[model samples]
Target: MPLTDLRQYIEGLRSLGEIQEIDVPVSLDLELGAITRRCYENGAPAPLFKAFSDHPSGFRILGAPAGTSRQPGLYLSRVALSLGLPPNSSGLEIAEAMAASLDLPPVPPVVVDDAPCFENTTTGDDVDLTRLPVPLLHHGDGGRYLNTWGCIVARTPDGSWTNWSIARMMLVDSRRMSGIVAAEQHVGMVAQAWADIGKPMPFALALGVEPAIPFVCGMPLPAHVNESDRLGAFLGRAIETVRCRSVDLEAPASAEILIEGYLHLDEKVAEGPMGEFAGYVPVEPSMRRPVYRVTAMSHRNNAILPVVVAGEPVEENHTAWGIPTSAQILHDLRASGIPVTASWIPLEAALHWLVVTVPRDWRRRTGIEDSAALCQRIGKEVFTTKAGAVIPKVIVLNDDVDPTNTRELVWAFATRCHPLMGHATFEHIPAAPLLAYLRTSEKVASATGKVVYNCLPPDEWGEALPIRASFRHGYPPEIVDRVKRRWHEYGFH
Candidate 1:
């Protein structure tokens, strides 16, 4: 079977030298967040702080659970390991493989009578969230966040749809939390359905689930499709769940900690103004968002709390979320008959750029006459989809330029794309409000223009294409083979 839970996944990381456990006492203020941020910047091991400065005993925090690796041929090592893939899987392979799995039949969750999380349970007046030491993930954050890396489970009142999503929640008090529930988000939609009938939405906040759980939860799956089923489909087995102590929902049996609660749609609180994943320190003001009231808390002994410290590039937002998101896009594109050879959501782009590579014979395969027309079709296929809402720009290139290779992609984009005529833009589409460049109208309406840049030849140049001037492809095969074979003999290394 696949690595089905957090402990199993952590051991896999240990074998790869992708994780580190800190014995020294760490603070929940800014110290821990700073450490995780530096890990992302330097590609250091995921820091598992074993001791806390304030709430030292009975709790542990794991930061950068799926951060990118700097080691050679292991950039996405943690992500791959978490999803039960080999440590050396490439970005394209990860995305394309997951995309193909979307075609499989969904495997619904199987409810189990007991789980590790059920070892200890507290209900009614005993539920105190502050005892867990929610981290102030950044200096600019309004309050310590409790839901940065967890999954929130909400089901439609009619029991037809259930959604699992990651939304930031700040500790409001002993039993209350403030979080975002945007109307466009699935959780928000589910809450609204309950609100129409005048009842608070019951929910369960699941933290430290199996590595693959959070990644699947973060995917922009179709509105009615269950995230648990998608996860089960990917794993080729049924996922196990245990009933929540207070709520009528069932949470993943893989969760290390689970908080049962009700989402008060009428209850709003001042939230936000935090450093986010756009690679920028926040300067914005706080806004009112929904509140979550905790009713029950359940956990195992010395339960681990996983955190993202979401900011900059290559964090969970880019790794767990971005990788799976790109997989859905690749699946959508291929399902639409677009001959995409590879698709990649680059880590350094901070979730702003989606790089897609099409076969060199795209013109012949797509049966399009010109680059502009091809770009328009690509735009129509991408921007019109649900997963494309967060994407501001897409870069389309011939498969000769690998989308996962930043150097080659940058070179091809800079050299081949015509400044004015090589792109097509669509307006009045939904966009994430966090985009730094959105105009006030766009931000308010959550609508903006999305562009697709063409990095291939403008017309069917065919045999007239210029040769690539590079070490890998510029020389004849015989000469290249000889050079590679004698590279060490020449003392170049």
Candidate 2:
């Protein structure tokens, strides 16, 4: 069944031993952020803060709702459950399922008049953000952030398209919030269009919606495609949404909290210096960014706020956004005729390294250094053509090994990859400013942008002859069944 709400999703995590309850009083300051980061690094369960020092009754915070896990194959397991698939689904299976669903008809959203998110409404002078415990996530953070894991819904000036995306927002005051809107991002493009018209852009920030909402927001769907509709297609049912009290925008009906606001063209504030997903703080001083003025705040009684403290790997930044995004990119690339088998963005690379395994048949089809050329082409195409500029390194591997398994990838590199012959380079690809090498370096060169194609020879793409001969294709079915039936008796277990 589809996850109906945040609480149900949390319950599902609990069933899988993926959640921890913390009853002791915890500060919303840097302490909670540090604890969450440690949990992410260790692949531990999501933490439920039941006792906050200054939170309202029944107001709890959940951190890292979906993240990397200690158990093998659990990452894909959690993601599959989030998409209403079986728990034991593999990464390749998840990608194939998503790709198959792309051919299914789009499921339009069902617009309703009233919803639970509007249970309590605060507007104008009565809207006090300080009442809610907005966590000061990191030690070096400038201020409390409220929209790290939230989705911002905004419509175009012509009202032709509505964009849903995950953008970070820092609390500036009771009525104001500030965040960067990059021109390359869909939200930023829509915001700029409204700014050009000299009008405040209407926006609705949906917090703690169904787990699938944020996952869809992180996906790189084509332009003019509504993520809400894509979400419905994935769920195999229509999504329910309600109009905001103060704006024309609509939010998920099951959202725990909703903030209706406008992005003023003239209003700007100094934002940032917070630890970013790249695992480092911005070296440059905070700069002025677009300011969002909150005109109304609405929420269900005793709302549960989901917070994502972005910094290192395995956190919400990686598990909730990065890995799935890479999978989406792989789907797109393969659909566009690029031969991609599996993909992984390693957490150690700060979610920038994308390793894709390609089928050997593709290499044979395209002669002349197909692996190296394909790696360079993919890097440029994904980085410059789409929203994949956030990714930096691209590694191409053979289909024999799992791209998500670091040990397997390392083994392939050690045994097959030739340093100089396998390496490939590209230049002038627009990259995110937050890349560690780009942020800290004094002299940045073109060679900084590079991808490696660790290609195994055609003969080595398949398993060894002895191992292949031992499989079901080589063994008689009766003999194999007898061996399986007597395995426990032979003490194999």
Candidate 3:
């Protein structure tokens, strides 16, 4: 069964011995972020910090909430626990499970009169955010960040659409925050709607929700779809949500901390220089972004704030966002009549690379004559989708190439792609401004280009097919079977 709450998810990790409880005194300034970063990079147990004497006892910190594990058979156990799957589930299995949820009827969230998030409340002048253990995520960051692994809940003025997204938030003062709400992002779109009506946009920053919540919230689903509804459908149950004390919105009942606020329509503050998911802290100057004014804050007893120190790959940003993004692409490609057998974003690529696979007999099945033609169709379908906003590059390969295997991806990318004629670019699409390659103009216009590197075999272009020189395909079944049977004798492990 899927874990329903953050604490339950933590217990699940504990069962697998994937969680580390640290009672040692720790500093929120940079020590916490460093330890969390190492966990993500090294696959150490997720840290649960409880000895920050400077902060309120009602506050704790959990880091690397969904990071990939170094364990042999349970590399993605944390992610699987979040999605309600077995510990040994593969990356492709998780992605396909999420994609299957797209076919089910959405189950809207269930509202409760009260939840754990309502246990304690601070309103108006009492809501001092500085009292919390907000950590400095990176050395040169603009300020201490407080929302690295949280949800930003916003709805349209007409109340027809509610978008739950993940974005960074930097603390400005006790009651104010500066965060990114790029115009192309869903939160920014809704904020613009509120600006048109001459009012501040109401938002709720929900932290420490159930493990599954952030996965759907961070997904780039269609603008018409509500993540809360899709999340309920994914688990085949309605998620419990509660009304915010000061905002006209709902937050997850499982939240460890909740902050209700209004985003100023026109006001701006310099934010950023924090390390991002792609592994690099962009060298650009601090960009001015919209400001958030906190109205109320609430939390349960001994609240635990979950955080993602997103810098390198294999972190929450890569696993959580990358898995859902692959699912969305797989759904869209199949819907568009493309024969995409599998799709994946290798962890080390940091969500920049989308690896798509087609069956060997795809040419005969779809009657697609050439590699270039198929590449065009794939690009047209993928680059136009909402999830494609952050995908800077896509790689097309045969089903035999196992999209989930980064080594195979690297092998195919290096050997199969023709330098002169293997790739195509799609320009003038919505740009994800965080990418370092984007120019100032593209960022301002919210338009950029995407590329597709055709790694499909040249056999599609009328040449005789070349044989794959791998042990699985190159050798006969009898020899492979014999080798496999004697693998222990060969001392391979």
Model 3 quality (TM-score): 0.96
> lDDT (CA) for every model shown?
0.87, 0.77, 0.87
Clashes of each: 0, 0, 0
Would you estimate the TM-scores of all the predictions? 0.98, 0.89, 0.96
C-alpha RMSD for every candidate: 1.3, 3.7, 1.6
Deviation in angstroms for 309 in model 1?
1.0
* Model 1 error, position 122 (Å): 1.3
Q: Would you give me the overall lDDT of model 3?
A: 0.87
lDDT of 1 by residue, 1-493 (tens): 5888888888888889988999999888999999999998899999998898877588888889999888998888998888888899988888877898899999999999989998888898998887786888888889889888888999999999989999888898989998778899899999999999999999999999988888898898988999999889998888899888898999888998899989998988898877777876567788888889999998889899998888778798998878888999999988888888877788788788998887767767878777888888888988877788889999988888877778988899899888888698898988888877887788889999899998877674862457899988799999999999999999999
lDDT of 2: 0.77
Off by over 4 Å in 1: none
Tens digits of per-residue lDDT, candidate 2, 250-308, equal: 88887898998899757888898788888877667787888999999988877888888
Residue pairs whose backbone atoms clash in candidate 2: none
Lowest summed lDDT across 10 adjacent residues in model 3 is found at: 459-468
For residue 361, model 1's alpha carbon misses the true position, in angstroms, by 1.9
lDDT of 3 by residue, 198-291 (tens): 9999999999999998999878898869999999889989998899889899888888899999999589888887999878887888988889
